[model samples]
Target: MGIESVLSEHRTFHPDQTFVDQANVSGMAHYEKLCVAANENYEQFWADLARELIVWKKPFTQTLNDSNAPFYKWFEDGELNVSYNCLDKHLNTQPNKVAIIFEADNGDVTKVTYKELYEKVCQFSNGLKTFNLDLGDRVVIYLPMGIEAVVAMLACARIGLTHSVVFGGFSAKSIQERIKDAQARLVITADIQFRGGKTLPLQAAVDEAFNLGGCESVIGTVVLKKSKDPIELDSKKIWWHDLIKNQSTKCDPVFVNAEHPLFLLYTSGSTGTPKGVQHSSAGYLLHAMNTMRWTFDIKENDVYWCTADVGWITGHTYVVYGPLAMGATQLIYEGIPTFPHAGRFWQMIEKHQVSIFYTAPTAIRSLIKASELNKESNP
Candidate 1:
């Protein structure tokens, strides 16, 4: 039997004419036109988008390579740096534009402009060079949702090192498995994470993972000090501030092949062993950019917010890559929805004037429940 619908509604809400006029996709006719164009010549369609959206070190001759069957490649002949596409390109146009708006759980706010972010990425990239990490070397990032996490990921991409960002909430055992699987050369994490009025030890987990053994590939750990209290450090540990202090903010971008592995993200291992999924440079960026523009109707002045951790795929695409690639300002929150108050998210949306908001359905449901509770209590 066919699956039956649990709920149905005939009501429909259309967008205001003002919004439709300014939207990227606009109306159904425009979308259908694009669909037709793409369906008519799919390879050329992707090629056109790749050329328009990406700044390539070397232009691609072929769009897709399917000679290998199940394992296919895209824009294999081209070369480009993911970091450059995200930050450097934006500098010429909107250097002073706010790239990241960080909202801490305690209600503090910090903003970083494009030029500032570029310099930080460059400095961190140079600092990573001091560690003697070479091309294709994997670095694992374990940090909270903040600017440093973005900087670390971009820095790794800038220097041609593959980065795997593990969610900050993952246990030490999970961290150990990812580190071993990725064979990470270095691990970057903060001293602590403040979330929902709780101080969680991030660095301690990395250390615990090391103590668990089997992470021999990792050479050192870069710790971003988030806590006020002093923490013990060994020769293998280095403070992030110290590493980038004296470094030059002029690290050159290392352009890699289109098919070069940009980063590795692992599955939750719900069914079996967690498998690492590798994403390439050009194709992934292209898709992310396109989706950001189409789905969010992203604009230059819009403050976009994706309420997802940087460790997840949504965060990787929307919070970090997609928005930046489009030169759109984004907001990153370092707290849960119900922290401090149930209306925290709504307050932020109004405070930041976020034009586009992307979140999971579970988050919406929680907000609804919170609203109901608040009303009952007030009544």
Candidate 2:
């Protein structure tokens, strides 16, 4: 049986210290009533959630259609843009609020406000249009966890292009497979990927993938320079900064239907070929908003950190889409906990005052061991 099948254990974790004095913290009774209402009328529940959480260009007429049992269509007639919901909605109320706190592996830090993010997304969107690609064109993004990575994905969404993000650490064979599968005409990758005391030549891997992986559809490669050292450029390679420096930052967002594909992410299929999983734009946005608000108790003032690479779904959902859609600021650290020192993660929490943090169990075990070893070695 699949997990998450039994979400409710007839109890709640509401009214925590974060909301003890607020009227919104009416205790478990409120959640119980909601649960009962949702269970009794799922259609109305979903419709209400979408209406409240999502920013729609055109209101939806239908909530769901499960006629095709295996595949269900939701918010069938709604029109929206994921990028707009994430950055644009917060422009009026909190333009200066930090949307992303990017800390590189080398201890370099940068903050992107909502207004800044919106402009950058628009600029990148215009830059992407320079390729003369039409709506629904695919762009494969093989980038590390950085502000630029977020901007790239949002740019694709803003222009109605579907982006397939391959993990930065993925091998050339993997990148080639995903790019070929998506038939992407453009590829965006970084010059290098830094992890602790190591560096991976990411663009080299992308180039190798193109040579070895049947990339006849690829027109050009957009390279992001994470390192200060200038990388040699070729006819096929375009500097990411050069493309955006003179571009217009006032591009309009293309409104897509709710069921339109937002992004195509791959799953590591141990036995067979990795399969691309497609996510709908509005459905995904709403799910992320509701999940973060209820599960993590994400607040407007909270600073969240999910220790997962941007390539993975955890980071894609929490670090990029979910928190941003909720108008919440989050930390995007492009390094591991064991990097520099075992206490790096703790130091970051204190430095940024992170309220909620999520990580894999494996990371927890490794951190514990590293902490003990560091204490022994230092003492």
RMSD of each: 1.2, 3.6
The clash count of every prediction, one per candidate, is: 0, 0
- Cand. 2 Cα-lDDT: 0.89
TM-score of each: 0.98, 0.93
Q: How well is each residue in 1-379 modelled by candidate 2, as lDDT tens digits?
A: 7666644558766555646544342457888998898999999999999999999999999999899977999998989999999988998999999998988898888998999999999999899989999888889999988899999999999989999988887899999999888899999998998988789899999989978958888999899987788568899889999889899978888999999999999997578999999998988889888889888878878899988887988878988899989999999998888889878889999999998898898888899999788789889
Error of 1 at 215 (Å): 0.1
Identify the leading candidate in terms of lDDT: 1
**Best TM-score goes to which candidate?**
1
What C-alpha lDDT does candidate 1 achieve relative to the native structure? 0.95
Q: What is the lDDT of residue 219 in candidate 1?
A: 90
Candidate 1 residues 181-221, lDDT tens each? 99999999999999999999999899899989999999999
